[model samples]
Target: MARVNELKRQLKPGQVYRREDLTPYSNAVDRHLAQLVRDGTLQKLAQGLYYFPKKTAFGTPPPNDETLVRSFLKDKRFLLTSPNSYNTLGVGTTQLYNKRVVYNLKRHEEVTLNGKTFFFHKTPYFPKKATPEFLLVDLVNNLDSLAEEREQILKNILAKAKTMNLAKLEHAVDEYGHSKTKKLFRPVLAEMKKTRHAQ
Candidate 1:
């Protein structure tokens, strides 16, 4: 029980933890972890992941997306973005998506932790955070999966591009945009250049 208390002291509410994190406290860490879950000190999110519940007015709050994801991936090198973010690009995407998309170097499968769904895609590269530029490139890259009208979104995005951070947008395309997105954006960038030269 002393070891359990010591482990509990090490945990922060709303933070996710892995089994290996507790091994330093006791050799029988698994049994202590199971007991902690039974006693409400920790909530098991998955086979190897657990979270200390944060009590609130409503109930125990779930772990933040970053917390859960970092624990699940066992690394900090992943991007957490949602399809819903596409709606913010003024690209005529109005449908709200009820899922999260994770671009990571590993773990290419859908995961459910603490009642939230996370779709993990194995990608060679992704930015640490979602910049407006990166989001735009990503939206175009995954247009087919979104519920909005594709051609209309494309049109609006191109029209709005004239007012965006052109350099950053182009850089994002060069770095993260897939072949299809690059092909689609090439003419738009050219048109923007023509308009600039005309002015």
Candidate 2:
């Protein structure tokens, strides 16, 4: 297990490792992994993926749902998104309401991480690249399509654009989505681009 300790030492907190990844380091892979788990050095996040058990300076274990989602994905085509669904639900920017869901445009089921559950929703670009802001607008679009309070949520996001960064927020609507998305996300996206966003 000298090799296992070496491998473990080489990995960072949020990085993921699989059984196959250890073949180069050791011949008896399964036993070494089991020993690490038994020693409390490694934690299995899922069937095949394992991570160091320590928390980063940001204050959490390997990851929450969002961070894990990024590791699980092959590239940028898909993003973990429940915000679009939440936005669609018309929760708006109501104070004292800190409900967060987990899910993405293409994914159907929900995944849980660190005792927190998240829900994924459907989007046109399912199985495709989903930049962060595009995910935001798609989520806002979802809120716009579903809830009775769509406009208010749109306004809330628009009003908070400066805090979230106008350029990046507009990029979500511009880079990955369509003109319709721009029309839908215009109020918020435009307002964010300006110093003071208003009607």
TM-score of each: 0.92, 0.52
Tell me the RMSD of model 1 versus the true structure: 1.7
Q: Please name the candidate that would achieve the greatest TM-score relative to the true structure.
A: 1
Clashes of each: 0, 15
Q: Per-residue alpha-carbon lDDT of model 2 for 1-199, expressed as tens digits?
A: 5788776766676666666666677667788888887887777776555767557576555555555655554233455444433433333533332234433444666655444555544454542445445556665555543534656666665554446666777666665455666786676555555655443
For every candidate in turn, the CA RMSD to the true structure comes to 1.7, 7.0
Best by lDDT: 1
- Candidate 1 lDDT over residue span 26-137, tens digit each: 7689999999999989999988899998899999878899999999899898999899887788878899888999999989999998788999999887887898889888
Error (Å) of candidate 2 at residue 188 is 11
Error of 1 at 20 (Å): 1.2
**lDDT (CA) for every model shown?**
0.87, 0.57
